[model samples]
Target: MIAVMLEILGSALLGLGLAAAAAVLLAHRLPARRLVLLAGGIGALLGAYVTHEALGPGHVLVTLLGSLGVSAVVVSLLLRPAAQAAAPAPAHRAVP
Candidate 1:
């Protein structure tokens, strides 16, 4: 009961922290800040809930770790690839 609640709270905090770090470190690669934060927080919460249900109580550390992993994956999916410059078209040669 209480343990479960604590796990949820902890997982959510961890998720938010991870999102903030990602946003700061990879601002160019990530989407909007709000979206990243939302995805990370929700993903972690969902992960924690699922893990807790599957593993049951007495496994708080494992559950939190699982939640963090899930949150990271969710945030990573939102990342955009680095932009590349377009190549110029080759000049055509005139035939004699």
Candidate 2:
């Protein structure tokens, strides 16, 4: 339907614009351009998915899974790298 198509197009454009704006703002503060881009991309993808799912008829589990997947992607990307970076390296021990 034309209405559905228009809705999707609108949401997609909004998602892209918001994501770009977020990434640009983050890039100003964050040194890792890649990480900010990753965050923005994930956010946009998730937003689009949520919009589509909300507009269409879908099962509850499917929506929940989609949302959960998005959350996992974002949380992992943001936290895992920082955790790895924060861990202290073990000191070299001389063999007896």
Candidate 3:
């Protein structure tokens, strides 16, 4: 039980840290800050839960690593290319 709780806490922290770093490094490529953060946290939590369930207890380190990996993947999926500048419209001429 305690291990599970610790795993969750550690995973969440790792996820948030990863998200923050991505947001800072890939700010232009990522979406809104709030969305990134939320996704990171939730993704890590779910990852930890899934990993723990699959591998069972006594694998906290592995579970946290999995959670971090999952969170990174999830955040990376949200990345977008930098926006391109729009071309200017041509001037209209009056008809004779």
Candidate 4:
């Protein structure tokens, strides 16, 4: 059980790192959400392939879905603050 948990955790972190790096590289060319989604999707497919090769064919779908979810969450957590910081401040209105 502990080994399984560790594997999942490791997979998630690996997916998160890969997605985050891709998103960063694509940040200037795409919207934050779109970049994140694209990166996460790519990470999912890659993770699935790796897991299938490493752990056999039975685990591909599960690892793909898990990596997708983990990547999305990590990307959002990473980019949200940066988005908020980059947003323009609201303009002040003149008093009536």
Candidate 5:
């Protein structure tokens, strides 16, 4: 049903969003942008899968795998690159 599909997709998107936020929080201490990006992607994937499984009517394995894959791809492509690019700005000092 369309409703079911919508629910699943919506949940997945929400999860992905949350994961990106979490990753940003974790990124603060991390030195490697790649690692942060990767971590964010993983977090997003987990979020998407959990969201989908909680709302969708599917087998546990299917739900987990499907959501994980979907979330991973979406978050990795959409969020990871962008997040990784953001670096702390250097403090400006007065010119001698």
Candidate 6:
């Protein structure tokens, strides 16, 4: 049981990392939030499917929700700073 829990944790981390990478790459072409959402959704679906295949459908919903949360956090952490840095500073207005 412990080993199986560790395996699930590892799988979740792997899914998070991959989704983060994909969201970062997609950030070049799409808005960061959109990319993150897209990646998270995809990761969740994939994770759920894989977990279902390996562990049975009983685990699918939990894995799907967990992966979605993990992927969103990973993407936000990886891309939010980059997006902020890339954005232009607001122009200062002179007092009349």
Q: Write the per-residue lDDT of candidate 6 for residues 1-96, one digit (tens) a residue.
A: 554465466555656566666765766644555556566655654555555566654464565556656555545554434344467888999999
Ten contiguous residues minimizing lDDT sum, candidate 5: 74-83
How high is the CA lDDT of each candidate model? 0.95, 0.50, 0.94, 0.58, 0.53, 0.57
lDDT per residue (tens digit) for residues 1-96 in model 4 = 554555456565666566766576756544565556565655554555555456754464566566666565545554533333466888999999
Clashes of 6: 0
The reply for model 6, stretches above 4 Å from the true place, is 1-31, 60-62, 69-96
Which TM-score value belongs to model 1? 0.89
* Residue-level lDDT for 71 in candidate 4: 61
TM accuracy, model 2: 0.38
> Looking at model 4, which ten-residue stretch has the lowest summed lDDT?
76-85
Q: Which pairs of residues have clashing backbones in candidate 4? A: none
* Higher-scoring candidate on TM-score, 1 or 4: 1
Q: State the local distance difference test value for candidate 3.
A: 0.94
Question: What are the models' TM-scores?
Answer: 0.89, 0.38, 0.84, 0.39, 0.33, 0.38
lDDT of 2 by residue, 1-96 (tens): 564454445443444444455456544444465655555455545754784567564343344344445534453454322223466889999999
**Taking the tens digit of each residue's C-alpha lDDT, what string does model 3 give over 32-87?**
99999999998899899999999999999999999999999999999997889998
Candidates ranked by lDDT, best first?
A: 1, 3, 4, 6, 5, 2
Q: Where is model 1 more than 4 Å wrong at Cα?
A: 91-96
Total backbone collisions for each predicted model: 0, 0, 0, 0, 0, 0
In candidate 1, how many Å is residue 88 off? 4.5
| Model 4 residue 41 distance off true place after TM-score fit, in angstroms | 8.2
Candidate 2 vs candidate 6: which has greater TM-score? 2
Between which residue pairs do clashes occur in model 1? none
Q: Cα deviation of 29 in candidate 6 (Å)?
A: 15
